[model samples]
Target: MTDNTNNTPDGIQKFSMNYSERELECTVEKEGNILHLHIDNNINADLEIQQDGSLIQTSGPELPPSNIDFIRKHVLGQDAKGSVVATSGE
Candidate 1:
C-alpha cells in the first residue's frame, strides 16, 4: 500500500490581525495597479497605486487605525496597507 499526505488547507496562506475586540483576516494579492484585500472570501478593500508610490483605499465608509511605519520598518520597504475597525464616540 502507498501513503500520500498533504498539510495545505485550501492551498492558501492566511494573514490576519486582531485588535481590541475586533478581528480581520485577509489574503493579499497583487493585480496590475491594485492590491486586493479579501475578507472571509469577499472583496473588502482595494488599494490603488499612486503616482508618488503611495497607496490609497477606495472603499469602506470609515478608515481604520493603522501604522504605516509599522509595515515599512518590518516590510523593509515603502509599502503600506489599510485596516478598519469600529470606534465609539466620546
Candidate 2:
C-alpha cells in the first residue's frame, strides 16, 4: 500500500530490503508475474520461480522495463497473492 494523498502521478509502490541503500520502488499499473533485477543503469535481468520452487533468471539490457511492468501488474495488484520479489547479486 502507498500514501496516495499527495497525488503523485508516478505512483511508485516502494519495497525495501535489509542492508540495501536503493529500495525497489515498483509501479502498480500492470500484472507482475515475474521479478526483475538491474544494476548501474546498463544491465538488466529477470527472475521467476515456479510453483514447484524452481528459479529462472533472464539477463539483458531490455529486461528491467518488462520486469517493472510485471511488478506493476502482479505484485502491487490486490488480486494477486505471493510473498515478495527482489533483486540480488553483484
Candidate 3:
C-alpha cells in the first residue's frame, strides 16, 4: 500500500492511495458543516458529505467495487485538517 497526504494553500486536503499499483486520490474541502469529497484517478466522483457523515455522490462516473470499498473503509469519517497525514496499509 502507498499513501500520501498534503494540504493546499486554499485549505483543501488531498489524500492518495496506491494499492496493488492502482491509484486513487481524494481532495477534501470543508465549508461550514459540509465537506466536499472529490475523487480522482481510480474513481472520478464528487461526493457531498453531510453533517451526519453520510456521503452523497454528486457527479462523475460510477466507481468500481474496490474503489467504493476503499473510500468507505479509509476515506470516510476521516477528518480533514490543514496538515499532512499519510499512512500505508499492509
Candidate 4:
C-alpha cells in the first residue's frame, strides 16, 4: 500500500493545531484557485478565490469569522500539490 502518513498525494496538504483540551487537524486540496478544506475530519468547507483576490467560503461548515479568516490567510494560499505544512498552538 502507498504510504500516505507522511507523504500527501498531489493537490493535497495537511495542517494542524493543538490546544489544551483538543486538537485541530485540517486537510486542504486545491483545484485551480478553489480550496477544499476538511477540518477535524468533521467540518468540510470550500474556499474560493474571487476576482479581487478575496477569499470566500462557498460551502460546508459554518465556521466563525476568525476561523474563516485564518483559513483564507494561511491555508488557501498554499500550493496544494507541493508539500505538507503543519502548525501547532498551545
| Candidate of highest TM-score | 4
lDDT of 2 by residue, 4-81 (tens): 211223232345322134445432321133445444443445555434322344433333334434443344343333
1-90, model 4: which lDDT tens digit per residue?
A: 322222322387777754224679878887766778887877777766554445566777555555655555565443322222222211
Of the two candidates 2 and 4, the one with more favorable TM-score, higher being better, is 4
Write one digit per residue (lDDT tens) for candidate 3, span 1-90: 211121112246677865447665777665443335565634445544443444445555644445544554455434531222122211
Structure candidate 1, residue pairs in collision: none
Ranking by lDDT: 4, 3, 1, 2
Regions of model 4 farther than 4 Å from truth: 1-10, 18-22, 76-90
- C-alpha TM-score for every candidate: 0.47, 0.30, 0.42, 0.60
Clash count for candidate 2 is 6
> What's the C-alpha lDDT at position 25 in model 4?
89
Candidate 4 residue-wise lDDT at 64: 59
Model 1 residue 88 CA deviation (Å) reads: 19
Cα lDDT, model 1, residue 33: 46
Clashing pairs in 4: none
Candidate 3 residue 74 Cα shift, in angstroms, is 5.4
Error of 1 at 43 (Å): 6.2
- Which ten contiguous residues of candidate 1 have the minimum total lDDT? 1-10
RMSD of 1: 12.9
